[model samples]
Target chain A: MNLIGISINHRTSSLELREALHLNRDEIVSLIPLLKEQIFSEGVVISTCNRTEILGFPQTEGLDVNSIIGSLLQAKPIDGIKPEYFTRFFSCGAVKHLFSVASGIDSMVIGDSQILGQVKEAFEISEDLDFAGSISRRIFDTAIKVGKRAIKETTIGEGAVTVSYASVQVVEKIFANLEKKSALVIGAGESGELAAIHLRDKGVGKITISNRTIERAEKLAEKVHGEIVPFQFLKEHLHNFDIIISATSSNELIIHADEIKTAMKKRKGTPVVLMDIAVPRDIDPDVRKIDNVFYHDMDSLKIIVDQNMQKRKEQIPLVEKIVMEELVGFFNWYNTLDVVPTIKSIRSFFEEIRLDELEKIKNKVSDEDFTKIEDMTRRMVGRLLHNPTVKLRGFAESGANIKEVLTNTLILKELFNLEDFPTNGKSDAEENHNSEGNDEKN
Target chain B: MSQTITTLNVLLPLLYLTSFTVYLYDFFKEQKAVGNVNRIILFITIIVHVSYLLALTVEYDHPPITTKFEIFSIIACSIAFSYFILELLTDIRGTGAFIILFSVVFQVISSIFIGPNYKVPEVLRNRLLGLHVISALLGYSGIIISAVYGVLFWLLYRNLKENKFGLIFNRLPSLEILEKLSYYAAVIGFILLTLAIVIGIIWLPKAFPDFSYFDPKLTGTLFVWLVYGVGITSKWIANLYGKKFIIFSLIGFIVAIASLIVTNSLARTFHSFY
Candidate 1:
């Protein structure tokens, strides 16, 4: 309940201010220690191209927004970034924001997967700096899990959003085990280079680049860890590649249907994917009529990308539901942290009465009988306190209004006169039953 | 034993229906939790179907291939069993409901009208003859499954080509994998059909002196076998694959079902033994 977060994300600031406010690794390392020294008991600094957030538990009664910014400025001074540019979140707001950010719902490119990795790396940095406590670790770990669950339970991250990536995705739909497949990117233009890079990132076994100028082809091939083939020999070598992407400026068709037909003959009916990303259309569209050839021009790839983007947009509600579920689970654990101490106090109050009463009957019976009476009274007190203890913990971890739970805790403390009872001795009843109570909550 | 067989005969269709329902739900709704439940239900149904067939064989004193309806039930069980194995091996569950629906229909027809033939001929009760019929039924089951996958492949291929992006396109596996599975099923069918034909060629003449090689059932089966043989051979040599190969496999399946219908209902053949 003592959490607070300071964020200068894309939503709250201009690109110029965000750039100035962004903290690198060395900057975050220096700033975290200062923030810990001045204000936070525990904290994590998440800095990425889109956002830089500092989430922490405040050490004192008053949280000064300026002091936190001052600490940041001390670590890495910015020219004109003002305190008004940073948005602040408190308590449940902070927790919800963290979950949404990790789940990619709050991303600039909604469902940008890199944000989840950035969140995890921030947590690791906090842990490495000994700034992450148990509570901080649990919250961050829960955020990571929420991110994963969102991806697994919804289609938010499915398909390709970029044109070059869409070309690779089309090939993937027709082929499995990309590591066993080969690729050929013709022309070595910017689009062709991007296509080759995407294919290489997908672990395609071999990539061959062909261009009119050998110098550009060699440069791109080396960058993608691929081989270069002379542009004139592309027709003869088409059968060796399972995927072919053409992106060139030529107005004339660089790849013809007859050449592809010849390749399919020697390839023995194996499937081939051809992506023509050029503005003027490099590969012949008629190649799609071949038996095992799947051909896609830029228009088709754009349609696929647009459809995928729409699908991701439709999945926002599902991802938000996942974030809500994880937030509730996190609050259950967070609320239990408050309830455990109160539970211990209530048990101590009851044990005090039971032991005091047992002493009154200590001398009225034989030693064996006294032992039996003591055992019976202990069981009686345990059974009497069991339901209330469980109910109290349940009310706390139920993720209801925090004020309501706190009021109930106050009423229990006042009703039992638990404040007068010392919280040290004869509290064995709680430890025995607390695990069962917590297990039921979980 | 007859009582157990009767109970199982009634229960088998219901189990197949349940498996198909759950699988259909999983395919449409994409519920992973329910998908697991569907597989377990399917596994139990297959086990129960096997038990039913065993009980029927024990009670009737021969394999459950004596009548056309009985063979329908056997083919139903074989299809379900083969599809279950394919689902397990490939980890592809989208096509399971479509495949299992065939089992549900066949088993329902079997449960409604099929009964034990007490007057089956002694020659039909031979173990070698039982093997031949069972193998033939299994081969037909494989062909049926291959045909189903081929249909799915064609549907998905059309969806992709037209850029429809509908539920069928989203749910079905990739075109390449579907084509591979269809080809694999065809190969399995061709092998099993060859075994059945070889067994029949060795045993049929010695058992029946008047057995005619030109019997309607014999010629029909030979035609079905030769169609698949040619299809498989063309795939290897002539590079007939992809959508073309799938179309060919589907034609072979249609020819097979036509042969079954003609030999059973239209023609007077030597296979009628009851």
Candidate 2:
């Protein structure tokens, strides 16, 4: 599978450029239908504040991924937007990049667990659009595991000083007239609690702390006098809150910036100061440049400690370690996955041969003898396949693309008919037949 | 209660300073081993600080926040403790070490004139007075820490702006997080300061009979209060902060500390629980 990643990450780029390039959820929905027009196998959209990446499983006869991006954005010109915004494509590189990004290895702050959820949500949206399939599912799930591993293995962000507090200042910097307003802290952790505490002391009349774990957020809510509210109820109760500081550490950018903008738009542009303290940051930074949608980071809690510059310095080594290890680990595992379908196809063909031969001789054999023959056939196939499976798995685990090696080895030419299986991952003929039969019932 | 008193003018503050030295060493050295050592040493110092407070509490038969000397020392102690918690939570190692060092120095300086509040009659003890005293002192601790962060932010901003230093900036998260943290901390400080000042003003007529008007402590506190007020207003209203705001924060710390010293020297305040 060919993977093309188009992203605008923590690089310096204007919002206008990003907007011209970015695909809103609705736009992505429209584009998903468009992808049915392309030969790409599967697709997912990840629009974070720092970056907007589209990971596509392209056909082997790969065309420009930009057409997908352009078609999504409707061919709008992004002014002076550097090539830096867009990253490289991959035969299987997107999986590794995604694993690292979701794992917090690629995050500004290492050990931030929120990116996993943001990634999952993007996949979810893709799934809703009927685009995300096995690869998306496996890759996104692995991303979560990688994130959990970062937290478990390192103290990259041990103190969990979320930068949600900084988002408040972003608002303060923008409006400079916050005395009349209140802020809602949507989730409590290092970021939400800190934001609420800041707002409370800002003499804000209201400071509400809502969290998936409302009980956990109670102390902060009571301390800040924002009141305790459940996370489930937020959608309905959101109208009452003005500034929503969401730091739930959810995988998705839970509060879509557009949701806030729309909510505020209906209410005389009530400034919804959304500070994301969960890394990959809670706030979609894109929302900040949006009209009246003040946003902030899920950066480190350096703000509360006040010695952040020094602290960030201290965290460098740990972050580097996390990023490096994840990079290596991801490359290995991704390469292994790349070789999987070939292995599966090879195994399928052998099984198909064995089944056909058995069926051909069934009438000539006794039932008991047939069972024995089947077991012997399976053992023989396994013995023959053991070396390649073992070697390929080892290569894939270390971020080596075994499929490339297999291609060079001409294993495809020797053992199988490449056209029948289709390198672009066309559904196996049997699956197509089965699905077609199922469809006939409908 | 008076039985524990020996009138030993003090060598303890010096010892705390020594402890601060250890914490400083731990903070700047960039070693986890050093942090472990510092945590141990700071833990001991915390014990010492708590003991000092407890001993005084027994001698005076109240919380240690009963005298200017005790208040200053306790505030320093509280700051150290709170900072440790923050460090442990954030796992941001060296920053807490420096803060502890600063706390140690502040405590040492304030300890020389560590004015202890004498016993008060039952009539002087009220809920508001207690809240006023504790919150005010806590506010002092928070502000002191905030000022430290302000200094860090200023240093960071300067380094980035002038290219004089980037090590600290590079090591640090984005300047935005530091500035945001400073703002949040100052806000919390303001809440406590406001609470403290409000109660101080309300009780003046009853607490000090001859003082129907405002006193030096009142004025000094008002000045700090104004600084916090401006800080808060500017954040919410204009979202502006820079060297000026940092300077204001530093000034707030200086003024608040000075007035606290002056007030303690002048009278044994019911609110003097450092």
The best candidate by DockQ is 1
Candidate 2 C-alpha RMSD relative to the actual structure = 17.2
Residues A243-315, model 1: lDDT tens digits: 9999999999999999999998889778898899999999989998887788888888898788888888988
Output per-candidate TM-scores for chain A, rounded to 2 decimals: 0.78, 0.53
List candidate 1 stretches off by more than 4 Å.
A10-21, A30-42, A58-87, A127-134, A152-155, A187-194, A211-224, A230-236, A247-253, A265-269, A278-281, A306-318, A336-442, B1-7
lDDT of 2: 0.63
Q: Model 2 over residues B194-266: C-alpha lDDT tens digits?
A: 8887787787667666763455566678888897788678667865545556666777788777886677676
Give the count of colliding residue pairs in each prediction: 0, 45
Candidate 1 DockQ vs. native: 0.37
Local error of candidate 1 at residue B12 (angstroms) = 2.9
lDDT of 1 by residue, B75-136 (tens): 89899999998989999999999999999999999999998776677888899998888788
Candidate 2 lDDT at A368 equals 96
The lDDT values for all models are 0.86, 0.63
Candidate 1 TM-score, true structure as reference: 0.82
